[model samples]
Target: MALLREREWYAISLRPQGQHRRLRDAVTRAGGHLLALSPLRIVALDGADARSRLRDALAASRCVFTSPNAVTCAARLQALTTSRTIAVGAGTAAALRRHGIANAIAPDRMDSEGVLDLAELQAVAGQRIGLVSGEGGRGLIERSLRERGADVVRANVYRRDVAKFSPTALKRFDALPAATALFVTSAEALDAALGQLDGERRAKLLAFPTVVASERLREACVRSGFGRIVVAASAQPTDLVQAATTLV
Candidate 1:
């Protein structure tokens, strides 16, 4: 009890609804109160000829899905092909499994660098690759693959819009401590979450300790005026939970 009282037990995740369960469970098991502070919503985009475009692009030696949302969007946009596939993390790999992608593998480290480190991705001087992701992301992955002599094509399968919570919702959440640390996964979501707050509220949010998924996100937090930021080694929910447990 004394050890539990030494640190505030609240941990917040700013991801979408379908992305919450594992993190929530991890936080609860870690003796912390998990909160969902979603500031963005993912909407898959499909054009009239979306299916045809996806079919053409996915006709490759390998295909990479950047997120669970990427897999979700791709599943809706077109029929997944028989090409070898990869997911960026455990959450994403699970989503793929639910979607019947049984052979999918997520790297031990969940990030672009991890994806790039896969033995399968190396020594592909003339192979074709397709990346299914949201509008903007994985630029490094694409660039690195190109440099490695793979022909890579990309398709934006979804769009993420700002979450719309009523004033009542924000007011209710205010009852939770402003010093509640946030688990921020993306720079865009961080900006959106902070944008919803007033100057004072934003200040409070920044002053609260934050656990981010990457150094890039940490830099984004710094630019957005976040004061106390901890960069987790990976984007896994378990990593975030373990990080929260060790915090002061």
Candidate 2:
């Protein structure tokens, strides 16, 4: 995505730490300020220990990391037989790389459809594959991979819970003189942020050009009366920035 900011831009990140840093830096370096909105819901993995369960899954199958969160968790899950790793997006692939896991492959697009297009996945059609992600996500990857004859085993590594909004975010929201623009990565984040605000703050936020990462999230914004909702081509920050150009 190209940098196009006619007005001062405020970059919003709804994802976790690994996903946020690089994109936030990219936006800021390109002349936009950042507002971090993390709706992190702690994911309680089944069983007494998350790592042991993840290890069991990894040992039995290849791994598909759905987000940077998944990548971070999978990277930390004590190597279990060196399973194959696939990332849902470039940022996740980068996360795996940063953690010294070099075999991770990312698709051209970040969605489930993009993951199905990988030749490696295509070749492994009857094999068992492990999915690493949080709860409450669309099961597109799991369904699609299963349709292609892959046995998808899900490994819930961590949980997602909403984080408290930073004082900086509140200050920024209060200072906006007119209808502004907002970029978000997930519905959970959007909901969490809105949930944290008072009625006055919600009114101000509702009057903005809103951009979400997926069509599902767009619907969420529409339900909340967001002024305009544009879905990013991919969840990548660069893609979000590109979408921002059209919104502006």
Candidate 3:
């Protein structure tokens, strides 16, 4: 993180495909200023003729976008050609709409549990579905869909690459007070940020009031020794900003 504004203490950002701009804008509109600083980037790897494979996968009976990055990377190769599309979160759904993919199935809750609860996935017998995601996920959705008698396949289109922070950003973060509110979007981001900190920076992270998107993340933060955790409804920028504004 970088650039600590006096009133923007709670504007901490977590990695979910680098979507802090929308959140910061929303917070500013709500009469609060939120600043986000991140050096981590998500990059797509070599997937052996990725464009062709992704094009083929998109033609499945149903397509599930595991994250915003999946939607973005797949869209780069080709427009979604599936009979139906599903997004794992509001951000991913918004990305889909930007690519002209409407009527995407997005659950009220933005997690694997909520995605499984959808009516479209319930009776998926004899269906062929495509899971558009990156590597290193729990595979719950894929397994559940298979259990429902759907032939499931995957197309991993991207991976997260943690970037090194400059000396200036590190100094800025170290200077932030413990009163600064931290926004922990994903468990991975929390882990990465904490791993980067030491001495006073680590101490401040532990003491900072944090806003998370899901109960799962809140539980993770609890284990990581974070106090004053606030869980938002979803990872949407609006939801995140609302939680930060109200809590911090």
Candidate 4:
């Protein structure tokens, strides 16, 4: 697909529900239109058992937040304390700072492997570690902590649900212009969005130039038959938008 510089640049966001505002605003600022496609909904876990788990995790020696959503959901349940906090990336670290946890640290790489390479986690034998995240993701962090002889407490503060798109929304996606770039951050969200489309629509979307958040996601896009892929510097909205706009 060729990008006509004279035409308006467009970007398709596959972020979760209520999470497209920042990206949308960023795209607008760059003089590009954003096709917001929410394929997942973030549901906070507020049951009694979940609360108890969160409390225990918060009281641990070291606490790690998997994502910004995890930080938000955890903050809603209880006051954030100044425990030895680690965030998966700069965005999650910013979320921690917003909740009054200023000393939170994040790795430059902004991924699970990066978190494991931290000096604080290197000597974690017999230490109690708390993992705050959504359900069924970031298993590598939890499993690696245990292998390092740390007592890991997993607090599942939220869950991702597959969101339903309206018929109108589906039609809009099907009619997107060829100059549109697909911005994908989460492989799961991308899969959920692709699952909603018919074979023809799916193939058409796969042919569009895609901007992925990481090399891992680039590989996922490759396996999904995406012809052109660009890896963003980080999962941040600015980086994703910058990478997407570069194609034009």
Candidate 5:
């Protein structure tokens, strides 16, 4: 936490949800400036069309949830007959428990590749698997499971939509102190930030350092001509703080 205090400014790419207040406090206590990028909205998949497909996937041999939003959506999809539930991370697993669903497993690492690396899934030949996540996420999990002879069915439970900029929205970035490091959790979030910025605001942001969670997002930033893009070792907040400290 002390390390994070060394930075003059920061841009937090968390959606404008109720949970962001805690993160905002953390940044302020660390003595870093924080600009809240528009929150990503989660739309549930509760329509009749989606319910039928989700029912089919729920009958699979096992179920996988890619995010907490997915777990919440899956819980609403009515009765599920899968024998096991695998979550991409501890957070997602807890979300499942919140919805009264048990038998959830979280991988040691919190990513699609890590989930596939689990011993339980490695030999899942001829098994049927259901993947629950938001629409249009990375396809690694689905592709890998299919290659391993598992019939993978993806159930999209939600869609992310960035918040529209209000009159006071730009002030968040404008008030930020100089030399702030922007933290981006995903490539999609980064794209939304860029799209939200005006031409001048975009140039100003390009001058600040950026911390991304994955190599893929870092590469995207580089290709977009961002000045400095640092990839966080992991998605955890501690890892992000360490990376920010290094740059600061």
Candidate 6:
């Protein structure tokens, strides 16, 4: 009788806390295990100043959301309204639709450069653009819009903090299978996740086949010493999981 090949796969998730359910479920359905290594925690900023900035963003001629977290946090502060709405990616656009902002559109490339490539943004000589996002990211979008002569107002609705991992989490990571793949989407999350690891563990992780969300992230993985890298179709949970499963 011929021996059967084993088909178990493992993927390390570096998404933010409370954002791993869909990816976990997808990995489970693919007959694989998902190890949570959430390196970032999202904190919603709903203070008076945050609310006022959100109001200004909503009142602008064009409003742009940088992430799903931005959409959710902005929705919590107040209603999302604008003449035209743009999301950095399809995921953010979906989040906006879930919050009843159905007219939001996203670029095909799903990045700062992609957002800037949109034709709608090309002719903004004297337009007010509101950027709804987390704290201290997506500066490229703001800068480019301003260079295009658009008055860009940034409304920071959330902040990303480095998450603390427990001892058990480190132990679990140490015990991960040799054939496991690393899934990295956000460059910030990647930096935070690797920063929390000791040298040995970090080197071991860099040796794994990494699946990144974009070419930019692939370059980041290369610079971070990841030996092998693969770019996923998009940052969507299903896409990332699908790409990871192919590695092992």
- Number of clashing pairs per prediction, in order: 0, 10, 0, 0, 3, 0
TM-scores for all candidates?
Answer: 0.88, 0.81, 0.87, 0.95, 0.85, 0.95
Model 3: per-residue Cα lDDT over 104-187, one tens digit each: 989999988899999989999998888888776638898999899998877878777676665876766766654456777767
- Predicted structure 4: lDDT: 0.89
CA shift of 144, model 6, Å? 1.1
Best by lDDT: 4
Measured over all alpha carbons after superposition, the RMSD of each candidate to the real structure, in angstroms, is: 2.7, 3.2, 3.7, 2.8, 2.7, 3.1
**Model 3 lDDT, full chain set:** 0.76
Which pairs clash in model 1? none
Tens-digit lDDT track of model 4 for 1-248 = 23324558888899898899988887777778888889899999999988999899999999999999999999999998847999999999999999999999899988888899999999899999999999998999999999999999999999999999878778788888888899988989999989988899898889899999888889999988898899988988888878888875
lDDT-wise, the better of 2 and 3 is 3
Q: Which portions of model 6 miss their true places by more than 4 Å?
A: 1-6
- Local distance difference test scores for all models: 0.79, 0.72, 0.76, 0.89, 0.73, 0.88
The TM-score, computed over Cα atoms with residue i paired to residue i, of candidate 3 is 0.87
lDDT of 5 by residue, 141-237 (tens): 9888889989887888778877666667677777666567777766776777788788988888777787877777778888767878898776666
Write the residue-wise lDDT of candidate 2 on 19-63 in tens digits: 467767767665677666665655545554667657756765578
Runs of candidate 3 exceeding 4 Å displacement: 1-10, 16-18, 31-35
Local distance difference test, candidate 6: 0.88
Write down the RMSD of candidate 3 (Cα, Å): 3.7
Q: Residue 114: error of model 3 in Å?
A: 1.1
Better of 1 and 3 by TM-score: 1
